[model samples]
Target chain A: MKIGIIGGGAVGLLFAGYLGQKFDVTLIVRRELQLQSLLMNGITVHKGGSSFTTRVDSDLLTEVSMKFDFVIVAVKEYDLKPLEKVLELMDKNQPLLFLQNGIGHLEWVESLPHHNLLAGSVEHGALKENDHVLHHLGVGKTNLALIKGEWGAVEELVSQSIPSFPFLLKQDFEEMLLTKLFVNVLINPLTALTRVRNGKLVENPHLHQLQRDLFQELLLLYPHMERNVSFEGVVEICNNTYENRSSMLKDIESERKTEIESILGVLLEKAQREHHFVPIMNVVYRLVKGIEREGLGG
Target chain B: MKIGIIGGGAVGLLFAGYLGQKFDVTLIVRRELQLQSLLMNGITVHKGGSSFTTRVDSDLLTEVSMKFDFVIVAVKEYDLKPLEKVLELMDKNQPLLFLQNGIGHLEWVESLPHHNLLAGSVEHGALKENDHVLHHLGVGKTNLALIKGEWGAVEELVSQSIPSFPFLLKQDFEEMLLTKLFVNVLINPLTALTRVRNGKLVENPHLHQLQRDLFQELLLLYPHMERNVSFEGVVEICNNTYENRSSMLKDIESERKTEIESILGVLLEKAQREHHFVPIMNVVYRLVKGIEREGLGG
Candidate 1:
């Protein structure tokens, strides 16, 4: 199987290295420097204090002209609009997998001409150390659900997955995405605003109370969220990633646009539509949006 | 007229310097170092481009004795509990004017034996420069209203007020305090949590909308708040104090206990009692409280 991954963020590099192990994978990086480096030395992934380099084909995003069995859209939500032309040019039968953080891209994905669509929530913690070096901080399962089209395409893609970078098939699309969204909504913005690591929210009594309140209020919107995921499970995730700064926090520090709109922004709109009162969420939404508008992040 | 001002924070020092111009005023400060300096150099007031020094009487809070016409309690709400013994020692008949930021001190003041009670909403912006110096940043009036006292006592107190620090008497106590409380509730906690100056709350579009939502929600509890204060007035206050850091923001920066409980805490309690929903306030309250617990402030 030949796979082409678009965009060269941490997630893009991570997918390229792992999928390159078994399948014919080509990484379409936006930066020329990163593409040159990957072409010269291949993609290097660091995990468990050991480093492995995978010889993956590389090309600039604009230079990619060949057909592939699948294309994984691994860019941020804000970066989605600019890729409309690229996505429109792709083959309708070639299944496109999206790995964005929030559910904000659902409407846009539905509008695309692609008939075979799959959405994924990446649990793996990947950070880009440089242009070509990707650090796989934690090993977590990537859950994939079919947003539209048949599951036969997904089965073909799954057969190519290696044991190390495992992908799990979820039955429900909304539940799979909502579970990840709920956790991200509760954790990311708070850590980014407070500029603290994940564990501090659960370790500090007052912060913990806030987390409880925010979680309780969020559950009101999707009470079924607890059926699939427990409050303890969310806290456990925070404890496991205790020392790690959340991606939202890292984006704010690096002055990159955050996925707040896809995360908290979508939730706020839903609250308004449902006419449900969520005070805690409203405050956080405004605060994060305020920081973004004030040029802390675009 | 003679008066004793308790607590040597910005408010206490502001009252001491202004009232010292006309009345035989004595400042009761907690710090022995501040007492020694005030004793040696008197109280200095810096306003506009000019500066003036007044020979005001100074004494340690532990050593305050003799009879005074009235005692003005100019301390934070958190500091009120520790001063129970000091308040008990004062003459009960003497009018005690309490100048606090929030409505949290309302219950504590009602528990005191003083029948001649008054409340004042201080509008002036004062910053403590040193042990004995205070810079008066803005010229605004002090609105006083009788909480449990006759107009005779307030008349005597107002007569001694200087022109720069004029005191204006209002008819209703709740209306007077609630107006100031409304502005404070909308500004203080948000600024402190975001670590921005007072003006940023209004200047930032997202923050301003959130402020509007919180203000609209808080008004349900006290519908009469807008009769004396307009929403524009609160925005004006933010614009006027654009460069000045709020006392709450300053407290958080200095790692001292913030006045959040006194401000937002009281409103949250009232929301519970009245069954009025205040979502944004609840979230901001928890965040500020969390930061306080983490010892960014007490």
Candidate 2:
């Protein structure tokens, strides 16, 4: 099987490195520098106390022409607009999987003409060190759900799971995405705003109170989230990734754009549509956006 | 007239520098280092292109034993608890004026045994560079209101105003403090939380929206605040202090204790008492406190 990972980010490199060991993989990136470096060094993933180098075919996103059995979209949600044209030109029959963080891309992905569209909730924590190097901080599985068409591609990926990185099939796409969204909504912005490690959300009483208030505000929008995601489960995730800086925090610290629009932005819009008063969510959303503006030379 | 000023902070040094020129002044400080520095070199005031040094007697807060016609309490709101005992031992006839921010100190000042009590709202933007050096950033006046007892002392100080350091008397103490409180509540926490300068509160639309939401929440507690403080006035203050960092922002950056409790904490108590919903205020309050803990070696 041939796999095409459509980003050189942490998740993209992780997938390309592990999957390349088992199948023919191509790592596609937008930057010429990253593409040149990837062509020279391939992908190196450091997990636990061991490290391995995987030799994978690499190409620039605009220059890539070869077809793949399965293509995984690993770019951020904010970066998806430019790829729309690229995705449109792809083989309509090819199976495409989106591995973005938030459900902000669901509508866009559903609009694509691909026959088999998969939405994934990635639980692993991966950090990109440089162009072709990544740290696989957390070893976890990817939960995939069929957004449309046949589920054969997702099932095949699930059956061919690697040792540490497993793939599980989820029954409902919205529930699967919301489960991860719940954790992201609670953890990401708070860590980013406070510039603290993940565990501080639960460790600090004041932050914990703020987190609960935010959780309550989110529950007003998705009343069924309580059944899908427990409050304690969110706390457990913070404890599990105690020392790790969240992706949003990392982005803010590095002066990179964050997924605030995808995570909190989506919720703010939903609240407005439903006439739900999510003031805390609104405050957090605007704060993160304001900070992003400040970080980006505003 | 002999005037004893308590606190060696920006406001304290500012008062000592200007008022020391006309009256016999004694600058009181809690730290021996600041006292020694002030004793060695008088208070230095740098305003625009000119600089002036005013020599004044210095004494530690614990060692001060001299009598004064009036005393100015220039400490932060959170630092007032430790001074309660010292205040009780003062001469009953000596009028005490508090130059603290927020209305949190009003009730506590009322409980003092002094014959005359005055509360002041400092409009000047002063930054302390060292133990005895201060940059007089903004040349605004100090608004003084009589909290209790006779108005003779306040009248004397108002009549003997120093050049460029004017003193205006306000009829209502609550109204005077609330006006400053309104600006502090809106500008301080937002600037500190976002780590932006005062100007960004108005420059950044997202933060401006958050500020407006917070202003609306505050109105629920004090319906008459609209008359005392205009939303336009708050924006104008941000514009006037465009390049200045708020004191609370500086406090957080220095890892020093913040006055969040005195400012937002008091308002939170009032909201609870009246059953008002100030979700944004609550979130901002908790986030600042949480960040304070993180900064203070939590």
Of the candidates shown, which would achieve the greatest TM-score relative to the real structure? 2
- Tens digit of per-residue lDDT, candidate 2, span B1-298: 8999999999999999999999999999999989889999999999999999999999999989949889999999889989998889899889999999888878888988888999999999999999999999978999999898987665778899796999998999999999998999999999999999999999999999999989999899999978899999999999999999998999999998998987899999999999998989999998999999999998
Which digits, one per residue and each the tens of the lDDT, describe model 2 over residues A54-92? 999999999998498889999888899899889889988
Please give the range of 10 consecutive residues that has the lowest summed lDDT in model 2 chain A: A152-161
Model 2: CAPRI class: high
Clashes of 1: 1
Which candidate number has the best lDDT?
2
Q: List the residue pairs that clash in candidate 2.
A: none
lDDT of 1: 0.85
Q: Each candidate's interface RMSD, rounded to one decimal?
A: 2.5, 0.7
Where does the lowest 10-residue lDDT sum fall in candidate 1 chain B? B289-298
Judged by DockQ cut-offs, the docking class of candidate 1 is acceptable
